[model samples]
Target: MKKKKEPLKYHIFQNITFLLKCIRREHPLLLIFIIMQVILSVISPVFGIYIPKITLDLVMGSADTAQIFLVLGGFGIVMVLSMALSGMANEGKYIMYNDMRRYYQMELFLQSLSCDYKNVESEEGQTKYQRAMSTLRNGDWSGTSIMIVSSIDIVVSLLCFFIYSGIMSSLSPYMVLLLIVLSLISLFGTRQAQSYEYKQNDLTAAYEKKLSYVIRTGSNAAFGKDMRLYHAGGWFQELRSSLIEESAKLAGKIQDRYFASGVVNAFVLFLRDGIAYSYLIYAVSAGQITIPEFTLYFGAVTAFSGFVNGIVNNLNELNGANLQMNSMRAFLDNTNDPEPETPLALSDLKEYSIEFCDVCFSYGTDTGFVLDHFNLKINAGEKIALVGVNGAGKTTVVKLLCGFYKPDSGIILIGGQDINNFRKKDLLKLYAAVFQDIYIPPFTAAENVSMQELKTTDRNRVEECLVKTGLWEQFCGQPTGIDTPMTKEITGGIVLSGGQQQKLLMARALYKDAPILILDEPTAALDPIAESRTYEQFHEIASDKTAVYISHRLASTRFCDKIAFLSNGKITEEGTHDELMQKGGAYSQMFALQSQYYQNKEVAAAYAEA
Candidate 1:
């Protein structure tokens, strides 16, 4: 769905408030820039037009050389000072522009980082984030840094226009009148052109996302095997070309509209200039005005038109930039999932029992129920094995318990208090979750284990956990040891195999050492022998802590206190392996089928013995 852009009034207030806040930071430097602009604006016509006009009049008369030299020298001095002031302002503008842009860019990123986690997971939120990022990257820094400095230009331009227009009005009131009317016409045209360009940002961003993925996946070494084996390079190339062509077509249309408006505006100014010059020449020839008057009036005419155009153009550009800037503001202003204003804090974590009573849930942007009327409860220090085939809502229970999502109906309680009553940050202190999808950061092994920066990590604990989990044996012989980087994303870093990566993540979870632990297929990538070793280590480590284990290998569940067998989003059996085996339900049937291969091997051995 397309997002509706906010009104112009909203953008105007947002831009002014934002710029003022940024300006309040470095008023001294920005003030100097403004003063320079004012000085130059007042002096530009005096040197280039007014002083010269006075000297020319004296030269044309029956006058002495002393009078002429005096005026000429005044003009020369003003000329040098004006040029130097203009140079200073231009140099200052370039530096301040970059610094302010960087400031706002960082602010935008920080806002995104602190936004509601659940919102980040939603499709609409992701789309807004992408558009907001495009605004920052696209060089249209209106309503933020660029707008701050550009405001000074617009204000000064209007001030100069008024000063120059006053001079023109003295010569002829019609001169000022005609230019103002032309500026009005140009304003309408520019506004229309900018409106189209503003909407084009979204279209361009969408196409760019697709085009970038195609290029990245087609060329990345990670996808190299699939690209060649499937022979999908041609397909990627074709899709990339189509996206590029469509994006270019949309961009080309915007450029064409802008070019047309520019040409029309240029002609209008030329016509205005042509008429003023022609009218003044007639006056000079008819003796209604002198050569001196003609010279001053001609200069005034050109300067007059410039002021009009400058005011209109800056306003147009600022308004256009306002659209993109508002997008960035929208993303920042979006609050996270609604919750209590003042939340209750948790007590000492003696018992971390969890119960999900008649919970129902579906993803925010999706319609299908991942968990429907699901209910499960566990006492403190109970080792429950959650076993199910794929798509049986095993992992959903863990997600709800961790409060990653809230149930659409019913309640969850932790330590006999409603889970929702505790704040999100406080509630998360309860569990250490190791999921099927793991994020391996590019950092030293110690920092990855402790999940802290290098300085704050406890070396002794890091060493002990690594040793406990077999990761230390790999690192012990290296120069970096615990400091060794984990992923190849960093220089001097090494890549770990699938099993090593999984083990490293497991070590991180172990290091957290929270009261309750949830592990989903923690040994999925390990060999059977390695898997058995990890299972034994996990049980020993989690002996006292409440733990939930999920694995496709039913043989691993034999060690749990009780196995909760899930089928079609409900617990079909709750008992020990021996009890389930005797009952001969779905769990027993699946277990027997899985053991068939091992049983066949034993029969072959018996026949060979005979």
Candidate 2:
């Protein structure tokens, strides 16, 4: 579908304002960068028309060698200035580009971090981010970070166009008019071609993703065993080859579009220059202009044609980039209010228990419910375990509580007030959650656990939690102790085992010690012994704090004050583990199934005693 277009003038103004902010931050580098650009833009036309005109006239007028040499010396000086400015302009572009890009990247990242929680997770929100990233990753002034440079180019191009138009006017006004009309035709054709190129980006992105999947799977040491054992190397090769062939075919189609557009532009420029040069030659032959004048007019005609074409081309590029810049703007301006501005802060959070009352939710339309009228209540400081088979909405409840997604209907309350009434960030302050997905950043262990940069740290507390979680021994072995980076993706970093990472995450949660603590399969990577030790300690550690944990191992739910079995979008069973086992319902059946191995162990031990 054709996207609705916004005005180029509006984007230009936006670009200016964007750059102005950047300039304010790093004015010295960017100011020099822009000034060098303007100087280069102006000098190109001056060299093409003015200096050449002067040299030709001087040489042709029977001027002395000494006099001509003076003019030639001036030519050398101009050349030197242009060369130096050109070098600085090119070099400064990349340098300033890196700085501006780093700045913009941080700003955009912070924007995403501060965005509405729902906006960061929804399909629509993810698409906006991908689009914004695509704009930023391009290595040119057209990229989101350097759009100010492109904006400046437009202004400089316009200024140069006018300056040259006046210089060319001595030849003929009609010539300038003719050039603009033809150049505009080329501009329109090229814009359509470029639009076609961008339309193919979705296909290109898909192809790149496929290639990335193959490369990642092939290159990763973790996947190496699977690839070798399964004999999947040939399969990967075939998949990669097919994708490359498909990309080549798509590239051909894209190139064909550009070639077709090129034909139209080539024809227009050919006709324009042919008519122009023919007119100039005729005027000179008829004695209407002298040899020197003919030389000057001929130069002007060519330069003016190029000047008109360049202006139109930049205008079209700006128009195209305007659409791309929309993605950046959309993400930055994603301020559609979902929560209250002046929300009540629950500074004292120990008094509240999270409740989901008559809650209904689905990931999207036409999908079956993940949760439906899922009513549950817990008293403050109660430790509850939500246990279920996969796809039973155990994780869904956690997400809703964390405000990652909103329920389609009904309300989630904390301390009798709707959670929606509180600021999203402030509401999140009540919980310290360790989710199933493990993401370890390449930062010091202390920073990773604290989720903050170092200024001051409670070393004793950090070590105590690490020791309690079975990670302190490994921490002490490291040269920097807890200050060691957790990823070998950086220098002198240490890679942790999966179980150790889980322990680190647990230590992180313990360090936060928020009023509400949620752990989703926190000990999945640990052995039975380690898991038992952590669960036993959790009771003491989470005392006076509301705690919820999700685990498939129903045996571990024995540690909770209450065990809730979630099934078919509702809590099918809720009670103490012994009470549920006595009731002999779904929870009992699931627990028996999950604990059958342990049951065998107990039976074997009893028989041995006999």
Candidate 3:
């Protein structure tokens, strides 16, 4: 089915109207202030047009001197009043602009955070989010302020144009018509220039993303050592310089074209002014107008030119803001996924037994299967260890179980009910996972480990989690303790080692206290003692929870009630650790080799300790 398109004028007008409505709703005083400014703006041009006529009358000695003095005084009074009102309005506009942008940016951030994780993982949704964020922070700062000012500029300009043009047209209608036509052409050119600049902004979004990645890799302390060790500095520098050059070139071209268009517009204005002046001279020679009339018409034409230029430039600015607003609106409008028919409340989660029947999955349809016809059953309170080599679909299983991705064809059941029918939020609350790669948020040590915002978290829970993970001493002995900021430049935050960070992450899982826990290589980087101690702690805390572990280290699986051995997306063996060793399959072979190596190392470590 074909869809209808909204007319551009209609959309622009609607946005402007909405902008005014929102501002009035948010800050009524500011609207009143701007309305007063607009009135002063309209009156200022009128005063400017009449003041010269009054001066010319006094000079030519053709009018009452007292009347001319009064006109001059009136002009000064209006000018003073307009300037005072305009100053106040400008201040209010600045405040309103900042407030409006801040309000909308916060609203968008909250909405993005609340959206489904599945949609966020989608390629299109990610791009849309990135575009909205970049535009909101960069070019959308003026917010509705630009639209309000532009609309007022256009109105005042049109009013002045008509009033002045009407008076001047009486002297020479042809000249007034010629000025009007030129004004329209200049406005058209400015709008085209604005659209070209908007496209340039859009084209730079991908470059912005690339640039951000380069910065993260090059400058971040965590990536700093890796970058140098791997000699990735040159590669990243090349990529960064390339994107910077491209962006500079594109921006330069856009500016040059816009400047050229402005020059063309100026050339047209020059010709129009020359023609109008020549007509004015002819009118004066024919004795058709007095000296005062000649000055009035001449002043009016100049005022009209200013009006035309002001309206065109304001319109272009408003058009650019509209472009940013449209991008944000499009992202917000489309990112919402279809709502579930019935929400599954978290109260419904009772048992953690999981069943997958005929499950088939792929990252994309074009990509080969990460899991094919995969089936597994984990009993309630079962500690299952998943053994697999790298890229053996180990992490995919954990992601699927956590409901981050759905199977292309499968029925994944929890407590004999299909997970597809489960409310996503409720399902998320049912499981806790510690992935291989952990995110260290720029927050306090407690907040980073607990994954809680400063405003939303309970201090007691934060303390308790830290204590459980053996990180409380380090956290509290610091200058600000849990209240400390996490960054080095920030006050009162002490940095912890990598193993300490991992323990803190484990504390977060413990805090979640869900029925199911998934730990993916939690001890991958830990020393032998810490690694074994971590599993022992997990066994103690997760005794009543369905614990799933993924690791290449076979020594870690000894505590599991059941083990699944995977190779190339397929599970080839599943049983108790003892049963798998007896089967002498892939699991048995890998286990024997690792156990032998580790056993000798442990013996030597014990001898050193003795």
Candidate 4:
């Protein structure tokens, strides 16, 4: 069977559409502000160009002094008004940029969370995800500003250029052709440079991914100590330098291209101005133009060049912004997952029976089945233990029961209803889980134990769960009590030991009071006494609920009412502890070996005492 490819690459125009949708939908205020800035941009440059021409007429005294003063005054008034309007427009732009940044930051955070667990493991998807994240943080508003301003500049510049072109055309039709050729050449050359930048980005993608990983591993607090203790800082530094060199090589390729093209562009600009100058000289010498007209013509030419240059620069920036906008839009476009739309909201979760019939699952198309032809029927209130060696598919069974992954072929029923028919939210509410790996939340010890939002936390319930988990006296009642944060970053807060952290995770699960409880190696790191205490507490509070215990420890299997022994992808043994021992199968062999090792230890201690 072939695996389906992920829709990861977003089309360029599709990205633009995404940006527009985001601004229109999520940031309505900012979108309005952007529109205002665009209007000001269109008005401001034209005002500046025309005002200067009017001022020149006044300075040359070619018209009535009173009329000239009035015209000059009008130009001054418009200039002042334009400056004030632009200042207000710029303020709006700042607000709009900041708002857009905040909005996208939130969107990116939500998007990261919504991604499927397997997506994070995909090298390509993860790379793209991280780039999207980085750009979201550093380039959100900066990119938006570039896009909006560049778009506005392009529109304004073209309008100003046409205004000058109209006047120049009246004087000489050839001058309009000269202006069009120069404008096209300059704009086309810059667009080529922008396109090169996009290609350079693609070429250095692998190098940048390596650099990001090296930097993150070196600097993250979780890995920092390990990196320093292992003396890996120098190694990471070398890796980063290599990535930098690779990036530089790619950049150099693009820079060489740009420089070659820029020289030709510079020559084009010079030739265009030279021709315009020749026309001016001919007009003045033939008495077709006055001193004032010559001055006006020179001013118009300079203004036209400035306007066209502005448009070229802005258009180049617009191209780059389009690329970034495209990726962001693609991510946002699929915010809704392909999962069932009418998610079942769980109610009546007090029932505690579970069943799996002909259950089959595989990690992906390339992977073999983790569980095949699996059948299990667990009665209400039964405490079952799953015992397995490494790669025995015990954990996969738990994940399947929890609805994290759907089976490729099979039916799982809860209270005689197919599990798939249950809404995801409802399914989650049915069970409380403590996995093999612990999660230490960045919160107060109370909130960590309760696993509830701080604003509405039940403090007493947190205290009770901590005590029941056997960690309250040793951890929660420290200098700051339960109010103390769990992180080791600050003083007056105690950090839990590995066993204590495990106990805290158990406490969090206990607080949920779900109908079903799952504990997967929850006491692996605990001492014998702590392990016994946890199991006893687990039996007390979770007695009426269906409990699933997954562990490698054979001794713990004895506590459950029934044990399912898994070997490879199948359950090979199912019985009570005594039954499994009497059968002398895989579970019996492991149990005997473990019992003999401890008995031998006792005998060795006795011999030492003698």
Work out the TM-score per prediction. Answer: 0.89, 0.87, 0.86, 0.85
Q: Which stretches of candidate 1 lie over 4 Å from their true place?
A: 1-9, 26-28, 60-64, 138-145, 171-174, 286-288, 348-350, 389-396, 489-491, 564-610
Model 3, range 292-393, lDDT digits (tens) per residue? 898888888788778877777777877877776676665666554454697655567577788878788898867899988888898889999998888889
TM-score of model 3 (CA atoms): 0.86
Q: How close is candidate 2 to the true structure, as a TM-score?
A: 0.87
Counted clashes in each candidate structure = 0, 0, 0, 2
Clash list (residue pairs), candidate 2: none
Angstrom error at residue 546, model 3: 2.0
Q: Per-residue CA lDDT of candidate 4, range 131-225, in tens?
A: 56556565434555566667667777787778878777777888878876787797788778767776555456667788878898788876888
- For model 3, name the residue pairs that clash: none
| Candidate 2 per-residue lDDT over residues 433-472, each given as its tens digit | 8889898988999998888877777777888889888889
Error of model 4, residue 101, in angstroms: 0.3
* Model 2 poorest ten-residue lDDT run: 601-610
The alpha-carbon deviation from the true structure for residue 534 of candidate 1, after best TM-score superposition, in angstroms, is 2.0
Best by lDDT: 2
Q: lDDT for every model?
A: 0.77, 0.80, 0.77, 0.76
Best by TM-score: 1
As for TM-score, the candidate ahead, 2 or 3, is: 2
Worst 10 residues of 3 by lDDT: 2-11
Q: For model 1, how does the per-residue alpha-carbon lDDT over 1-610 read when each residue is reduced to its tens digit?
A: 9778545445655776676667568545865676787678667765577765787778888778987887788778888888888888877866676666677677778877777666677766776787777766745354455555556667777777777877878878876788788778878887888888877777777787778778988888768999899999899989999999999999999998898889888888788788888888988999988778888888877777776777788787678667766777778787766666778766644588777787887775457777667767778888888998898888888878878778888898776778888777777787877889866778898998999998888999999888877778888887888888987776667777778877887888888888888889888898766787887888877888888999877877778878988876667788888888889999888887776666577753432221
